[model samples]
Target: MDNRKTPIASFYANLQVFKGYAEKEYLPYTTSAGDVAALDAALDNILEEGIETVFARHDRIASAVRGSAQAYGLELFLDSDRSNTVTAIRIPEEIGALRLQDHLSENYNLLVATSLAQYADVILRIGHMGENAFIDKLIYVLSIIDNGLRDLGFAGNGDLAQLFIDIYKENI
Candidate 1:
């Protein structure tokens, strides 16, 4: 999460012996005798694919967010050169972090928030992970921020929809 990669975790292991069950399964996890092998294989596949596919996804989403923020003249609190899975930015003083989060969700049906305790009322976080990371979804995230900033009376660089398109072209 700190790295901003998907909250959706990816793991890889080549264990010689193991008990197989979904980690999400409750304690003393039990499955029908015939299900263990299938479950193990599925878990393995998911982990492998996540590593192979999701890092590229993280890069693309992170770049889009960074690019959009840059175009809008918004400050991203994290290191600009590093690519992270999460996009964290200080919610401008006029728009409190939690307040912005609520407004975004309520008005745009986009769910975003501050996940770290230290940033609770300060930095707002947006996560782009797994298959959920898509260009349209990224544009929506930026639009919500741009609209929120405008509604709060923050003058920013104009419409970001086209910026998203340009970025998409560059990325593709």
Candidate 2:
């Protein structure tokens, strides 16, 4: 029940895998010519694809977070432009991350993730990378936050939670 610690180590430990050796199919780190060639080929393929995909994913997640944070009444602690898929934003100190994460899981079957040690309670990191980084998914998270905050007596308008697009108006 302690809200002070990050779950990174515990999460992996909970998997309880026997760490005797690396998986059977994987090559060992010691350099064989075949392993070297495999590594080179893999590196070449990744260098060609990873950079482009990473930028694309980062952009999508950042832009989405920028829009939703205000709606959900979250403080933008990190710039979307400078972040990867993992964007950090601040939530109410009153609604601790563990409580919120648990509430989310129990009520909406959602998992809210946090970052490192000290800022774990206040800062929730939204990961918008890999196969599931869809805009709908982000909107769902915001929606969950909206309902959760209201349930916790937050005064912010809950309509913002439903806005999936990043929109702005120009003053005339």
TM-score of each prediction: 0.65, 0.60
RMSD of 1: 8.1
Tens-digit lDDT track of model 2 for 4-23: 36554653343333233356
lDDT of each: 0.69, 0.64
Best by TM-score: 1
Candidate with maximal lDDT: 1
Query: What is candidate 2's local distance difference test score?
Result: 0.64
Give per-residue CA lDDT, model 1, range 73-100, as digits (tens): 7777777566466778777777778887
